[model samples]
Target: MGLDDIKRRIAAAEERAGRAPGSVTLIAVSKVQPEGRVTAVLDAGHRVFGENYVQEAQGKWPDWRNRWPGVELHMIGPLQSNKAKAAVDLFDAIHTLDRMTLARKLAQQADQQGRSPHLFIQVNTGDEPQKAGILADELPVFLSSCHDLGLSPSGLMCIPPEGHDPLPHFRLLRRLAHDHGLPHLSMGMSADFESAIAEGATHVRVGSAIFGDRA
Candidate 1:
């Protein structure tokens, strides 16, 4: 499929969900994707990109940023403590703020750097142990700490377990956002995004659905 197709699907899904459409941001996940594909999307008017690997994002950000000054970069992958400083520099939004150490460092570094982007708490709403996120039961404590650290915990992001219905996880996230009074919900991806949109996803990451299968 193409970028237009992806946008159409998101719009239709929002309509089906009885929610207003076109409000949600579609982040073209360029993890493992070549620069040519990303460039094509950029030419096609996509400005926000999500990357999973720090090295990959590092390789791309400088050039992409120079080419499109207003382009936004979001880190949608698991981040290590060692890479926290670099991640803060590269990402316009850090989507996997799970631990306190990383959270504290991010706030301090952003304060030091004097210019860091938005931050989002990653929730293992799927309750997957292998993921890099706080458990659902542990989110409030995490968010409170993040607030204390001065990081704007604008929203929540999650990757649901494979083969499981993502709605439950997505719905849980939306509820958590409402309970916390956060307006953003960065759920959904290539496969189950329609359901995510139906469940009120404020941001959806589309990779292969836009660029075709990866090599």
Candidate 2:
């Protein structure tokens, strides 16, 4: 689908959720997509994108950044502590901050590099052991630790279990953000983004619906 089509979908979701126009930020997920596809997206005037891997983003985005000003990149996949500096340097925001070790690494690197992207604490709302997010019950303390480390996180993010209804997880994330005074909610994907909007998502990461299926 094209930019206009995605914008219309987001707009429709916002209207259904009683949100004013432009309240939700649409992040075009460019993970695993080639340069030509990304170029097409840029040519279409989209400035925000999401990537799942640091190495892949490093390989492609520097050139893209040089050519297109004001492009914002978000790291939306699991972040390793060793890659914290690279991630901090490349992304404008990070949506997968789940552990204290990585948070500390990011904080140190961001301070040293003199740049810090907006941080979001990822919560495993469904309590799935295999997921890479902090469990829901542990969020409070982890959030506090981030604040103590001066990360100053701005929101919460989650990937609800695949086959389950995602509304509850979205709602839980919304409440967590509110209780923590976080203003952004980076939840949902192509399938449940509309429902995520209904639960007050400020940023929705959409991949397939916008760029077609990844190879």
Q: lDDT (CA) for every model shown?
A: 0.87, 0.92
Q: What is the TM-score of each candidate against the true structure?
A: 0.95, 0.98
lDDT of 1: 0.87
lDDT of 2: 0.92
Off by over 4 Å in 1: none
| Top candidate when judged by TM-score against the true structure | 2
* Residue pairs whose backbone atoms clash in candidate 2: none
Model 2 vs truth, CA RMSD: 0.9
Write one digit per residue (lDDT tens) for candidate 2, span 1-42.
Answer: 666888998999899878899999999999998678889989
| RMSD for each of the candidates | 1.2, 0.9
Q: lDDT, candidate 2, residue 68?
A: 88
